[model samples]
Target: MTTLTIRRPDDWHVHFRDGAVLEAVLPHTSKDFGRAIVMPNLVPPVVTTADAEAYRRRILSALPDGHDFRPLMTLYLTETTDADDVEKGFRDGLISAVKLYPAGATTNSQSGVRDVARVYPVLERMAEIGLPLCVHGEVTDPDIDIFDREAVFIERVLAPVRQRFPALRIVMEHVTTKDGVDYVRSQAENTAATITVHHLIINRNAILAGGIRPHYYCLPVAKRESHRLALVEAATSGDARFFLGTDSAPHPTHLKEAACGCAGVFSSINAMACLAEVFEAAGAMDRLEGFTSLNGPAFYRMEPNTAEVTLVRRPEPVAYPATVPFDGGAITVFDPIFPIHWECVPAR
Candidate 1:
């Protein structure tokens, strides 16, 4: 098969934790991506314009020397989030979007919004100002079955919000099910979804494929194989409504291997490699560029990156780091669906 070359891609969603973990993982993402919208779910969360600006600066500082990677910053929406503040941040270009993580939805997410209606005023303001609301799209209610959260959220929360504020731009982040794909497809405008590399390559089976593989776990956790097929079709369809976002969350290795392992798939190391395999298998390698590089910027009304990057088809197994040594411990990297035999060595 011939190698594929395209404009350098941008990651619509990414979580680069602060300090050393950020330092270790940022390089993998920067190497493959032109830019990435940095998630703001730090311990305290980036709640204000000033916080976002400072966080952006830190990300810039963390970038490997001589790399032009840009970290697009975002604001973490909370009960106390002020609409004026959000608007000011966007106007000043300090932030690109506001993230809504329903409380208890995922890691370091307890600080998330407890009630979506309570944040309606904030969403209204975002809609008025043309800033998109990026959401985790899952119900935190313990009563909701883990596998049904995304579908249920669409019915109980997202659908209602879309009706209430049809003008608001919304990105259903890291969508993991067929329902999510259908939902995003049904809404042609003003709404879109980001498909993660891990979700695209694996399914709920990966988490328990041979046995319980904690590293394969993540929130809105991987769904069934049929759901995975739907994701592949949507992503490779060249539809502007779908785009790339690694959601490459990293946790200390110990945390991931514990009795109650944390939720997040650390895919930064082989994100493009994984995507290449998926697209190639689906015979949609021709559409990889738009999914990886163009759609996200188009949806956000931003410029697609000017730089170009290439992915050649070469056989190389992606090695999993048992742990990425950081401050006091190490962060575990998930074993991708298969040993990624096709490596994506960047052509500068």
Candidate 2:
């Protein structure tokens, strides 16, 4: 139990923002994950096959030497997205999935789909081609309570889409609530969910308890302690429908600590360590591989990595870097509010 080795995991969801930020953070993820589904919500966004191709090139160029990592590109779903282009990208193996962000749902999401109905044509084509749709899983209604968005989104938006296109593969990204867990469980085999490392550790208390802690704030924001417990149970339960998607978004410390702070948690640096701590505490360390490595590929119809990573439980706590510097400012790393004794041993 002190030393454990498993297939190198893939981050089913991640945001590698372009330029210096991308270069600064890409190494943290590539160090452990073999592949990552790169989010397309850049300043202009990656909406076409060409855009994805160009971005992929940038990611590969920024990758540190000797790191064997692949960026699984995706198209940002917009009302005017072309189905022909989408299918071509999927067929050519340039694109892995299409992201659906409800307009204004999160950072850089203004160009997202405003009306879900407008993108039905694209969804229909994706269903036909067996391409997966990764969703933010929260409604953007002004009247709806912020904490209630995910559950309400299921009842209002996602449920109808599921009913309309039963064959469309959907990944409920960052399932933060018990309601979300139950919904993903209730669906047919076509449905699965990605659980983030931060959600499993922190709840709303981490954000609004004593004072405003911006680093803990993220869209589809953390919910009650009960919801956190539900997510922990689901992740540790060894369910194939649930797997890792760090959503390890990096925001510069200046922006993150601003008046209206950005929503993201940069956990790529210590994600594996954090996960290992959770699993070991739950007495479910054996199931950690399923949550981190196996289930995601099974759901996406991709093969699990043959390479192995070993984590060793150290007598002293692992000290991950506090900040990663970029050109202008530094990005903060996620702190689990706990000491992590497990560290992933580097490949020799």
Candidate 3:
């Protein structure tokens, strides 16, 4: 089998938590990706231009020596987010997008926007400035069934937002179902979707197949197997509407193994390796470059990465737990959520 060498990929969505966790995980991400859109859901969320700039600097400081990774920063939208600040951040190149999280949607998201309508001014400013809105795309209503949240969000929140701000570009992050795929496909011009490596390879069954697997649990959670196939198809189809976003969220092991486990998967260490397996399984290895590297930059109106990275087809098992020495413990690096026979051997 032949190896594939392509331009360095950009992770359209990722979470590099602050401090030691950030230091430990940043290398895995920087080694493979040239740039990544860093999530804003830090302890208090990056809610201001100054906050984003400071956070970006911290990320740079945390990077291991000699690594040239860029962390594209974002603003966390809140009920009181000022539109002028949003515009200024974008204009000054301090922020690339604004992230909307319906409060309680994921980790450290209690400060997320309580009501989308309340943030219309911020959305309008983003639309006017041509800055895309990256959304978690799940509702926090306790009455909504957990599995149906994304579809409901599409019907209730997404549809109205699309109608209200027709010019606004939206990226539905880490989409989990066929409904999401169809939604983005229908509005391909103004809307795009990001697919995570785990969601593309496994499904809801993996979560319960061999008992409750805490590592498999994530926000928007995994959907049924059929949905998994749809995500795989959409990702490997060479459609610019779908791109790579590891959403490689990491939590301390105790937090994840507790009575109420946290919702996220730490997949940074194995993200590209898992993605390569998925593309190869679908017989679409040739299209992996576009999904992993090209489409995200195209959607964001940024230049594709110029540096090259290579991956070869070799069967080897990459050990989990690359060491999360924070919280006085280590967290397991999430696998593909499936057994993989093929491995990624990075070229020298």
Candidate 4:
């Protein structure tokens, strides 16, 4: 129980911004995860096969020397997305999935789809090619309360899409509510979800309570403790439909501390340590591999990693860096506010 070796995990969701931010945070994830599904919501967004291929090159080029990391690229779904281009990227192995942002659902998502029906052609093609569509399941309606968006998204958006494309694979990215968990479970096939490390640990109080802590703020913001417990239970339950996706987004300290702060949690640096503690405390340490490493590949229909990484539980808490500095600014790391004893032994 003190030392666990499992196939290196893959992050089902991550945002590696271009240039300095990309260089700064890419290694934090690459060091621990064998691969990650790179989100395409950049300033301009990656909507074409050519954009994905170019972004892939930037990720590989920014990858630290000696670190073996594969960036599973995805296309940002827009109303005008070409089915031919999407299929071409999926067929050529350049794109692992397509992303649905739901127009203004989160950061850098103004270019997202305003009307779901406008993208039915692209969704139909994706289902035919067997490509998974990763969704940021939330509504952008100004009337909907922030806490209620995810649940409403299910009732109003995702359910309708499912009825239209039953066979299309879908991943509800960074799910934060009990409703989300129930919906993912309701689907018998072609559906799964990615749970973020922050959601399993923090709640709305983390942001609204004790003044306003911008660092803890994220879109589809963390819900109440009841929902947190639901996410914890779902993640620890060892379900194939549920797996790890850190959603390890990085934003500069200045932007995060501003009047209008950004929405993201940078947890890539110590995500494994956090997950190890969360799973261990739940008395489900044995199922860690299934949640972190095994189930993800099964859902993605790929082979688990051939390489192994060992996490050893030390006698005392390990201190992870508080901030990582890039060229223009520094990005803060997520603090789980719990003891972290697990450390990955460096590969030889």
Q: Name the best candidate (by TM-score).
A: 2
Instruction: Estimate TM-scores for all models.
Output: 0.96, 0.99, 0.96, 0.99
Q: Judged by lDDT against the true structure, how good is candidate 3?
A: 0.87
Clash pairs for candidate 1: 253-330, 253-331
lDDT of 2 by residue, 245-265 (tens): 999999999999999999999
Q: What's the distance in Å from true for residue 263, model 2?
A: 0.6
lDDT head-to-head 2 vs 3, winner: 2
61-94, model 4: which lDDT tens digit per residue?
9998999889999999999999999999989989
Model 3 worst lDDT window (10 residues): 338-347
Question: Model 4, 226: alpha-carbon shift in Å?
Answer: 0.4
Residue pair clashes in candidate 4: none
Where is model 3 more than 4 Å wrong at Cα? 315-323, 337-348
Between prediction 1 and prediction 3, the one with superior lDDT is 1
User: Quick one: ranking by TM-score, best first?
Assistant: 2, 4, 1, 3
Please provide, for model 3 over 55-173, each residue's C-alpha lDDT reduced to its tens digit, 9 standing for 90 to 100: 99999998888777999999998999988988988999888889999999899999998878899988887888899999998988999999999999999999999999999999999
Q: Give the TM-score of candidate 2.
A: 0.99
Between candidates 3 and 4, the lDDT winner: 4
